[model samples]
Target: MSAAAVPAPLPLSYDDVVKNLEDLPSLPAVVMELLNSIDQEDVDISVLAKKVSNDQALTAKTLRLANSSLYGLQIKVTTIQQAITYLGFQTTRNLITAAAVTGCFAEGRCRGFDHRAFWRHSIATAACAKVLARQMRFNQDYAFTAGLLHDIGRLVLVASFPERYEQALAYRAEHDCFMLDAERAVLGIDHVEAGMALAEHWNFSDTMRLAIGGHHDPEKPGAGFLAAIIHVADAVVHALDLAQAPDGLVPPVSPVAWNALGLDEAVYLQLFRETELQYEEITMALLS
Candidate 1:
């Protein structure tokens, strides 16, 4: 028997999608507070630690992650302050955001999305981005956070339109096409827009918004450097089949991004090696 052809995807209301994003669920108060604190002219660690400390569960998780093998700390961290000191202000902020975002999707309602595998891929990509940033002498902490939330829009889509997104996933699986194509074909909008909308709603930095929105297609003139890093890191992860559902298409690396980074083969090999070595520990620490 011949294979059955897939039908066209249903059209979506672009306005409603934007509205849905406008009303997307707000992050926990502490997370929001922390996010705001990092943006201030002068961030006080004591105050930041107090904010985290107020949330007992988050404090504990933060401390545990600080002491986890992923960080390779010599002395155990018993409090949020110690964690802040050891992990550095930006790193601590990244950890808190990672915890908060992971908790946001704790109860995954998306039918086809594998939450655990999805996170595994995210953390691994984060690790890859961080290592790459350090090797290239960029801001490692920011790179890590950007990598972690690179696919936030996909999660948002799954959360808002579970059934439709599931069909999109199914279509991608059947045809072996990229998720971006599948989503655009099925849902009339892709995660990039969804994620960018969410980022804007959340008051994320312009750079972060750019990274989330342009990681897949950084072709526009004057694309953000961080977005370019995320673009390459995302492709590397997919190429290695690190995610639960890696994108079917490994989009070509942007010449502008590649030439700008000026990374050699040795760096790429080292990134893969470091990502492999730290993937499990970092994933465990963050996801546990």
Candidate 2:
């Protein structure tokens, strides 16, 4: 008999993806507040600190990370309010965001997707992006959060359609191709499409939404530097092998994105060292 034809994935639009987005776990109210306030400098840090302190689990992780050598603090941070007092609002906000985002998803049931590896890679990207931003005089906070969430569309797709995502993973392995190709083939949609949808629904900033939508094509028109930063950060994280998944495939960096940073060899080395040092502490605090 002739080989059976593959069934076509049902037609999926942003609306379809948006409707399924409701099924994914919601971010805590405090996290939502923090994310929306990222661009506003005059936001009440004191109130936000109180809100973070109210969540026992989030508070524990934030303080643990703040007390870790990541900050090299002389004194221990016992509460979110104190952590903010010591680490400043941006750092405290980052810690809370990290804790909340990680806590939102437990282990997933996608057979081919490795959840632990995913978060590790994501954290590594965030660390790498922070290094890049610091070196290049950019906004480290946005860079870090954008890097951390660059692939969140993958999570949304898997969470909303586990079986189809598993098939995409299987297709990826069988063809030894990029996940995006497999996702398009198997699901009729890619994570960028799904992720951009979710970002919009959640009222994330336009820059962040563009980073999600254009990370794979950073050189494209309107991608801007944030997307470029995320793209390069992702490439660096994969090259570092922090995730250490046997099946990991490092995607190529856009030359435009790489050249835009204009970093010399010494700066690259510093970034590698700092990212490696920072990634472990963040992982243990948030992923543990």
Candidate 3:
């Protein structure tokens, strides 16, 4: 049978969808406290580094990242202070947030769900967001955080409702529909909506909430600039096959977003190339 001939998905209600959202592990309290401290203009880097060092895994990751070539460091960073000094306060804090949230999703076996591939896609999308933010002269720090956490709701859904999520994925394939559309058709809401809800629940900034919520639909004027960047970044990542997911789609860029960002075709192409190169270095830094 043709793909279009597949049956429509049965709808599930939001209430019926058991939100194990509360049970999902949150960012470590110390990490959250450090993030709050870093936001302060008078943040004490020495104190922050000492706190980070207490978490053995986070400390190692920070040291490895600090020593990575992504930062172009000439000397090895053997200590937390050195890592903090070398990476800078803002970048170090961002990395800590990224690291803390990386394991929010559970790794499970699904017919076509490639865990590594999903992470690669996510990282590439994040890289694209960061680069695009610089190109468009937006808030790079906020963009990076948004890019990294945009799809967090998908992880929540998969972990919280595996059978239903699997069915939604199957429905997407069977109907040749976009994953987001399929998610909404099968469940009461899509990942973007769920992600927004979760972000709000976590007390994320309005910028973050909008970016994650409107990433798939940048034309929505309510989301402002960050949403537009994430939308384009998501499309670029998919088009470049950075992650090579079996069901990934190369979505179209919103002309409205392009115009608002003041980007022409040439500028977009140039940014894409730069983002691809940066993805390699950033991925290595984070994954190392």
Candidate 4:
């Protein structure tokens, strides 16, 4: 019949769903400490570097990214401190957080999941979010982090319960339903809900929790401007085929998102165009 008239999908109990998800890994302690330091009123750049250096893999990723063409620096960055200086505190923090989390999904074998492709999609979404935020004069840094981590729960679910997630995917294909709906039907929860729970457990900022929880539901209460930015960015990335798996749903630009950002068709087109051009460079830097 109609979209809304279709039977409402059954979802898992919050306690049951979240209990299995409670142990999802987070960014390393060093990375979390650095993030806390950077977001503080009085940021200590040296302190941030010290924390990053404690994780050798993170330090290497930070240096590799610093020297990548994304920055186009004249000089090489050999030390974590130098990398931090070159990338700036906020950009460095975002990169470190991304690098740490990416490691968790690097080796997993999720049925019907392509880990590399998933990462590419996430990087593209992050790039699009930053571009949109700058054009719309919102918080570019916050948008970038939100978009990068929005689908984090999917990684957790796939890694923890491959059979269940695969069945969810099958249900989506059979019913011509959205992924979230299928996830809810099979697992009694959707990635959005799972993601929000994880984000809360990690003690992310309210803005980040709201953005991740509502990325697919921009009109939901407390979504705010960040949610709208992420919602539009996620759609743009999927439309461009930036992810490993085909996004089953390519939602139209949310009218609420457009109205909230005051983005007319012309401006939206420009943002989309710019994002495509920058996608490769940003992806390489972040994923290197």
Counted clashes in each candidate structure = 0, 0, 0, 2
What lDDT score belongs to each candidate, Candidate 1 first?
0.79, 0.86, 0.74, 0.77
State the lDDT at 9 in candidate 3.
Answer: 53
| Candidate 2 residue lDDT tens string, 1-288 | 999999876856778899987788898898899888978979988888888888999899888878877678999989887888888888888778877887786576788789998889898998899889888899887788888888888888888888889998999999998888898888888999998988887778898899888889999999989998889888888888998965568898889999998889998898999999999988998888
Better of 2 and 4 by lDDT: 2
- Score candidate 3 by lDDT: 0.74
Give the per-residue lDDT of model 1 (tens digit) for 1-288.
988999865677656567786455677786776776766877667876787788776776677667766678999988878887887877787788887787676455877788887788788888888888887788888888899999888888888889999999998998888888899888998888888778877778777888887788776765688888898888788777766564546667878777778889988998898887778777767677
Best by lDDT: 2
- Using all chains and alpha carbons, the TM-scores for the candidates as numbered come to 0.90, 0.93, 0.86, 0.86
Candidate 2 runs further than 4 Å off = 1-7, 40-42
State the displacement of the C-alpha of residue 280, model 2, in Å, after optimal TM-score superposition.
Answer: 1.2
Which candidate wins on TM-score?
2
Candidate with more favorable, higher lDDT: 2 or 3? 2
Q: Candidate 1: where are CA atoms >4 Å away?
A: 1-10, 22-24, 106-108, 244-249
lDDT by residue (tens digit), candidate 3, 216-257: 778876977898888888888888998878876778788887
Scanning candidate 4 in windows of ten residues, the lowest lDDT window is 8-17
Q: What TM-score quantifies how close candidate 2 is to the native fold?
A: 0.93
Candidate 2 least-lDDT 10 residues: 100-109
As a TM-score, model 1 comes out at: 0.90
